[model samples]
Target: MIAIVTVLLAFPLGFFLHNRTSAYVVYVAIFGYSFTFQTLYLLRAWVGGDHSAFSADPEKLPLDYLAVTGAIYAVGFLLITLGHRLGAKRRNRSLAVDLESSK
Candidate 1:
């Protein structure tokens, strides 16, 4: 659910609003939220006195949670980067056309 929302909503909004302050906030939230949740998962067992978060056994790692969070982070970045590239191209083309017409 969180991943879906992040991809469908947060990512595109972040992309289109890149120049605005809200976009930076959204970027931080989406990316940070992912890692935070994953971190919580890794540390869940620690609260039970099982072991420290850092020294937890590799076999007990929250692989699925990490994968989902990572996927969300990657998707958000990819979408934002793609939008920026496309927007830049469009802006450049428009500027070039405007310059030619003014001559």
Candidate 2:
């Protein structure tokens, strides 16, 4: 659910804004929110003496969480890049057509 919302929002911002920076801004905002939420959840579970977050191995969970977070960040970046590229291509094509028509 969160992933879907993030992708939908980010892609449109990238596409409609037609700015590379906007994609990154969206990426940073999404990544920050997700990282903070996960960290808070882990901290809460740890403080509550719930080791379920750690599963059977206490030492491995942090690494797993980091890996998953990295994957999410990477995917978000790829989506934003794709949107930005497509938007730029469209903008350029339209600009070229307008120029030709003007001439």
Highest-scoring model, TM-score = 2
lDDT score at residue 56, model 1, on the 0-100 scale: 58
For 37-103, candidate 2 gives per-residue lDDT tens digits of 8778877887788875555455554776667667777777777777788888888774433435553
Listed per candidate, the RMSD to the true structure in angstroms reads 6.7, 4.4
* Backbone clashes in model 2, listed as residue pairs: none
Q: Which stretches of candidate 1 lie over 4 Å from their true place?
A: 18-25, 31-59, 95-103
Model 2: lowest-lDDT 10 consecutive positions? 94-103
After superposition, the stretches of candidate 2 with alpha carbons farther than 4 Å from their true spots are 1-5, 46-61, 95-103
- Report the lDDT tens digits of candidate 1 across residue range 1-103: 4566566755466446646456656776766776677567757866666664354555676666567667877776666666666655665664433436554
RMSD of 1: 6.7
User: lDDT of each model, Cα atoms only?
Assistant: 0.62, 0.70
Clashes of 1: 0
> Clashing pairs in model 1?
none
* Best-performing candidate as measured by lDDT: 2
